[model samples]
Structure formats: structure tokens, C-alpha cells
Target: MHDQARHGGAYIRIHVTKQGFDPLTQRLRWSDLEQVLDTGPFPDEGPTTDDPILDGVSYSFQVTAPGRTGRHIVYAVWRAGHADQNYYMCSDVRFPGGAPDPTTPPPSPPAPNDGCTAAYTPPGQWTGVSRAR
Candidate 1:
């Protein structure tokens, strides 16, 4: 990702590779891309893949980032040529911290809780079953 600190904007570069025969030159279309910050959704208008994408080449396009420092999610989708095959990618990025370390394991799940609670019970029929206690 290219950090445009001066312009207060950023861009992401994607490298695509194909194993088999290369397809004819076709326009690359970006279906959708969304950035969700801690505050709310941040929208960005990126470039279209009009350039001929040769095998094993990199493509870069402008992207938007949140101003505040916090974890963010970027959802992106694109399609090549006129094929029905659609490519989808999601990225979990953090401002000021950058991307998470791949070596580190993901955080564990939160502890489970029962659905029923004292607040849900009637006033007269107190179960006296305080889960906290």
C-alpha cells in the first residue's frame, strides 16, 4: 500500500499471476471496494483495469483510508475479461500499526454466556440464580 501522507490518501498494489495460457488483453473491472473504519464506512473510488494485464504483473490503484488510528477492514471484488470467475479479497488493516504479523496466531474466541438473565425474570418470581455470583 502506498501511503500518501502529503495528500492524506493511500493506494494499494495487487500482483496477479496466471499458470496456464495467457488470455487476450481485456479490460479489468473493479466490481466493489469498501473500507470500514471504527467510526463507520469509508468509501473509495479506484481505477479500472483498462490496461492489458500481462501474466505476472503488478497493478496499482488509489484507495482511501480512515483518518483516525484504529483497526479497519477492506472488502474488494474484481473480475478479469468476460469470464464468470470473480475474485474476492478481504484485508484487515490497522492504521499506524500496519498489517498484522502473519506468524502470530489469531485471537481466541470470547467466552460463552447463557441467554437467560435476572433482568429477564419477573419481579415476583425471582430465581435467585445470579450467574455473576
Candidate 2:
């Protein structure tokens, strides 16, 4: 999905299962990055809809799913900057290679972010939006 730079908002596109879809061997797993664009600070789900901002920086998304015969297939992508990593399922990952520059400054503080949320398990921590995905 493309953000298209409308209202400085991000876009997300998920692919549903189609015919001929088959399960792999190993269990599938993925890491949802809260930050994608190199810019800092993330916006909330519901914003004022004014003075919207969109940075090009992005984060990495790693997916490992079962392959045929219980094997495992790993997929990773450094894309989806405009997509804001707004995903809820594991799928194939396509990318060039390697992460972009690591020195890019983070986006500004999130003006608002109602579009994202997460739970903190033991040993992990949960916080408010502070970066972009």
C-alpha cells in the first residue's frame, strides 16, 4: 500500500489468503516495528488532521513462518515507510537488502496516535507512541 502523501497519513495493505494457499512447516513469526521512517516521533491513531507530517524513514519487519514439511521460511523487509507497518498478520517479505542509514534523525514526537497500541508481557515494557512505523 502507498501512503500517497494525503493528509500526511500512512496507508496499510494486507493480503488475504487466496486459493492454493498452503501452510509451511515451521511456525511463522514476525517483528512489528513501531518505527519505520527514519524520522523520529510517531503520530497517534487519531490526530487533529491538521499539520500532518510524513517522514520517509522506516523500520525493519522480520517474518518467519512454517514451510512445507514443517520447515521454516524467514522473510524480512525494510520497506513500508508510508505503510506505517500497519499490519496484523505474517506474510512474504520483499526488499532490496540491509537497512537504510542508521544516522537519520528520528521523527518528531507523535502529535497523536490512535492507530497503534501494544501490550507488555513479563520482562517487556509497554509505552506510548514515541516513534514512527
Off by over 4 Å in 2: 1-9, 25-43, 47-133
lDDT of 1 by residue, 27-128 (tens): 222332223322121223233334444222334555545353434445554433333444556554454643444576555556578775564766756686
Task: Give lDDT: candidate 1, residue 84.
Answer: 41
List the pairs of residues colliding in candidate 1: 28-49
Which runs in model 1 stand beyond 4 Å of their true positions? 1-55, 97-133
Over 1-67, each residue of candidate 2 has an lDDT whose tens digit, in order, gives 1133322323332232222222221223233222222323323223223333753233332322222
TM-score of each: 0.32, 0.18
Maximum-TM-score candidate: 1
Task: List per-candidate RMSD values in Å.
Answer: 19.0, 21.7
lDDT of 1 at 53: 43
- Alpha carbon lDDT at 10, candidate 1: 30
TM-score of 1: 0.32
Poorest stretch of ten by lDDT in candidate 1? 17-26
